[model samples]
Target chain A: SQQGEEDPQALSIQEGENATMNCSYKTSINNLQWYRQNSGRGLVHLILIRSNEREKHSGRLRVTLDTSKKSSSLLITASRAADTASYFCARSPSGNTPLVFGKGTRLSVIA
Target chain B: DVKVTQSSRYLVKRTGEKVFLECVQDMDHENMFWYRQDPGLGLRLIYFSYDVKMKEKGDIPEGYSVSREKKERFSLILESASTNQTSMYLCASSLLGGTNEKLFFGSGTQLSVL
Candidate 1:
C-alpha cells in the first residue's frame, strides 16, 4: 500500500499565480521531503521539513507539516511557466528505511 | 557539487535480452537505490544498497536484481527484458543513516523493451 497520497492529481494555473498541493500519509515519519521532476528527467530535491518543524521556506517554495494530521502542503508562490512540472512528496520512516513517495501532483503553469 | 550518472540516456532492447543499467555517484555516498518511474505511478523502488555488496529488495523487485560491487556504484539488472519493462529508470544516492539526508538523482535512462 502507498504510504502517502497526494491530492489534486493534476492542476493547471496561470503564470505568476500561486499553486498549493496537499499530501496525506498513513504512518508516522521522521521527515518528509519534496522533489520536483521535469519531463523525462530525474527528481530534484526541493525542501525537507522534519516532524519537529512546522514550516519551512526556500526561495518561492513554502512547505508546512502537521504531524498530528500526518499531512503536509507545498505552496509555490509567483509560479512561472518554468515551474510547470510534477511535484512529489516522499516520506522517510522512523529508521534507516528508504523513502516512499506519492504518485505526485502534475502542475501546469500556463504563460 | 554532487553528481550521479547513469549508463545511458536511452536504450532499446528486445524481449528476453539481458539488460544492465548502471549508476555511479561521485559524492561517496553509502546508500544507492534504483527506481522505475512510470506515468501516473510516480517512482517505485526496485532495489537499494546500504553498503558495498549489500542489497535489499524493495516493493517492486520481482524481476530485477541489483549488484553493488563498490561504494560508489550500483547496478540494476533485468534477468530478461520484457515489453512491460519499458519505462524511465532512475538511480539515487544518499548518505548512510541520516534521517534528513536528501537523495541525489541521476538524469535517468529511458529503456524501451521491444
Candidate 2:
C-alpha cells in the first residue's frame, strides 16, 4: 500500500496565482520529499522536510510538514505557465527505507 | 551532477517472452530502486538493491526479478511478459544512510507486452 495520499488530484490556476497541494500519510516517517515531473520525463526532486522540521523553502517552492497530523503541503507562489507539471509527495519510514510516492497532483498554470 | 540512465525509452514484447530493462547510474550511489508507474496506482516498487549483488523485494514484485552485479548498474527482468504487466518502469538512485536524501531518477522506459 502507498504510504502517502495527495489531495486535490488536479488543480488549475492562472499565472502569478499561488498553488497549494496537500498530502496525508499513514505512518511515522523520518522525512518527506516532494518531486515534480514534466510530461514524458523523469521526476525532479523539489524539496525535503525532516520530521523535526516544520517548514522548508526553495526558491518559489514552500513546503510545510505537520507530524501531528501526518500531513504536508507544498506551495508554489506566483505560479507560471512553465510551472505546469505533476507533483508527488513521497515518504520514507526511516533512513533505511526507500521512498513510497503518492499518486500525485497535476497542476496546470495557464498563461 | 547525478545521472541515472535507463537503456530504453520504449519496448515491446510478446506474451511469454522474457524482457529486460537496464538502468545505470553515474553517481555511484549505494541505493538503487526499480518502480513501475501506472495510472491511478502511483509508482509501485518492484525491487531495490542497497549494494552490489544484493536484492530486496518491494511492494509489487510478482513475476519480476532484479540484478545488481556491479555498483553502477541495475537490471530488472520479467520472467515472462504479460499484457497486464505493461507499464512505465523507472530507476532511481540515492546516497546511502541519509535520512533526508532525495532520489535521482532516470527518464523511464515504457514497456508494452502484447
Please provide, for model 1 over B47-103, each residue's C-alpha lDDT reduced to its tens digit, 9 standing for 90 to 100.
998889999999899889999999999999999999999999999999866535889
lDDT digits (tens) for residues A2-108 of candidate 2: 55999999999999999999999989999999999998778899999999999999999999999999999999999999999999999988647789999999999
Question: Which stretches of model 1 miss by more than 4 angstroms?
Answer: B98-100
For residue B85, give model 1's deviation from the true position in Å. Answer: 1.1
Q: Indicate the DockQ of the complex predicted as candidate 1.
A: 0.69
TM-score of chain B of each: 0.97, 0.96
Model 1 lDDT, residue B17, Cα: 98
Instruction: Quote the lDDT for A12 in model 2.
Output: 97
Interface RMSD, Å, model 1: 1.7
Candidate 1, residues A26-70: lDDT per residue as tens digits? Answer: 888999999999988999999999989999999999999999999
Candidate 1: which pairs clash? none
